[model samples]
Target: MEQNPNKPKILCVKISSNQRFFILGKEDGFSVYSCTPKFSLLFCRKFQKTGISIIDILESSNIFALVGNSKDPNFTTNKVFLWDDLNQKSIMEIAFPTPISALKITTRFLFVLTKKKCFIVEIEKRSILKSFSINSPSDIKPSNSFDFSLVKRDSLHIAIPHKLRAKIFYTNITKPLVELTIKLNTPSYQLIKFNCKLTFLAVVSPSGKQLLLYDLLTGELYQKFRIANKVSKVYSMSFTQDDKIIALLFNNSIVRFCSIQLNETTNRLVKIENQMKNVYKKNLINIEDDTQGICEFNEWNDLLVIYLNGACYRFTFDEIEKKITDTVSFNYLNSKEVLESKFNFNIEKEDERKHKEGEETKTGITSDKLNENKNKKTNENIENELTDLVELLEEQKLEDNMEKEKGIF
Candidate 1:
């Protein structure tokens, strides 16, 4: 993509799965378009841009579907019609059990999590393979709402958090093969949880006051840390590639990096690891006042924080400084003349290097030619000497005095 200095500063905003598409439930007819990564529309509806319109935008995936709920009671059917990117045609509508609470797509399956249950459907066949219900633990009452994250490891694992307990189950099998029930130390059971590589499980308390790390394989608490402020809630948590640094986002504004160390001491039920050491913490960009949305870290390690004022900032983590730096360099060019001069200097240097290489190559060729000439001269001299020797032998063979001397004897 070409970067235009004059181009409007557009911070790519990712719509969460929880939010419905903007085009959905709109009174005024608005056109539906599939927004792709290339910023091109696959299809456009006839509706014009109205001030108030609902567009259901999928997070990360640019595919969007137009959903509308009619005023009539009998017209409550939620039909999800999506534009097929490959075919560039609208596909047949599929009936959803409930208004889709969340939608996730993988290579093999497209998962739609509704308020009632989660449905795993095959993308190619467009058929539901299995349906799983999200429920509370046996001891606890069934929860109406639960947060789940799909885990892809040796087998597909779904981590579901109900009230106080976070349970993990194998999604592929009809019956759950393994189940893990997490019991937190905090009183408020709301856990902001995420699973990393199906091995490392991290959970933050509701207030971001405490963090719990656990090993899913052994069902043991790996480490726990307590933050000072209880007002700051952790929106997201992630581990670096080395697993040494644990990055946490607070209220979608501040980002903190902590060093992770494992303790060797054995504990009774939970294995106590080394305390989480806060290495780096900073608010890369504050968007508390903005109504647009919060910031998130992309897969490219780019930090995208959007402000309510329609201003967006993209930053990358600087390893040396242990801080985030804006991707756009503000002071890229001081003056056009200076930039032109610098470019000309670079061109001149490259041309001079090429000219010097050419001179050296020409010198090498000349030296080779001189050596060849010397060898040719030496060969010519040797040939002349051989010719003289042959002439002398011929003259000696034509000797008439030897026969005359023999006759005198």
Candidate 2:
């Protein structure tokens, strides 16, 4: 289902985890639509009046957050508005001095990212809990990429990569815990992304030649993939909800999926399966002016490629192969109100909390060091020791969880 076919290009596309609805951001405004069964238009809300920069929705709730667009004359870009779609009312609004670089929300907290700092706010109270900077005063610059991970529900980790080094901050504390200095002499231009639930960090190089994955719990380099040198453009890579599979988009149209597993003897991350599928076979001949968009995987392990043409294709994966199961187009239609009964859907809260406890055993940190290392060192010498200490603590935690499970069974 293509929405407005004659409008300007679609800038961004994202799907909720429930797989029932998707959102598209375009030149004029944003639209929400029903995605399951068959593509059906829900409604397109124009921002010409207030101007929205971005929209974020919780897959399991009716909560949505809108950030003001700088280009709009009616609103300031530094403000964020929280809305409840089910109730059809705005909850609250907050403003910041600096422009928001990225925005994310969980049930308990709202995460706002700036070029050098991150702000954590309590959702219900509409008050700031904590805010911190990712860089020091001397080295700070406009950051192009920032990644956030909420580890074990209570701990938030933010990764900011710079020219020669990348800093990883455990936002639960005051200072950065680790600085991963790139050993290579090459000048850096790469983006970093984190699998928030799994605590796996992926870094992609600008030349699209090298990809690295790190396990935050063990502080170990999990795996490395040498992307084909011939492929000049690699957009992004992400881990599936299960953290066992990874998907990578190349040259804007072709997507590759790889399965990750632990080697039995070595207990190291390994790629056990690999497959590649081309999404735009129809546009293969027209490569120059090919429209580009974004690729994302929902909770069900389905890969969705939403293109600039307002076309969305979903690829479902099976043990044997992957297939394109559905295609939806969003064609421009006049603004209209959708009846509540026609599109009413329920998202069970249990579905969102199912894996919270078990996954913590795999990524949890020992609670013993929370006080010991809370305020000890601010020097550079502690960087190397931090990795070793973190790994030791994680190993201790696994042993403890195993003994407790043994007692239960």
**How much does each candidate deviate from the true structure in C-alpha RMSD?**
27.9, 14.0
lDDT (0 to 1) per candidate: 0.41, 0.51
- Tell me how far the alpha carbon of residue 302 in candidate 2 is from the true structure, in angstroms, after superposition: 1.6
Stretches of candidate 2 off by over 4 Å are 1-11, 17-20, 70-74, 135-144, 151-157, 162-164, 167-189, 196-199, 263-290, 319-409
For residues 117-218, could you state the per-residue lDDT of candidate 1 as single tens digits?
Answer: 677665445688777666433322112123334433124455554333344333323236666665545543333434334455666655566777767666
Off by over 4 Å in 1: 1-79, 85-88, 135-154, 162-178, 187-196, 262-276, 284-286, 289-300, 306-309, 319-321, 325-409
Q: Which ten residues in a row have the lowest lDDT in candidate 1?
A: 338-347
* TM-score, model 2 to reference: 0.64
Model 2 residue 335 CA deviation in Å? 12
Residue 158 alpha-carbon offset, candidate 1, angstroms: 1.9
lDDT tens readout by residue for model 2, 143-198 = 22566555544565665543234444333332345434333222443556666364
Clashing pairs in 1: 21-55, 21-56, 22-54, 22-55, 22-56, 23-54, 23-55, 31-45, 290-308, 291-308
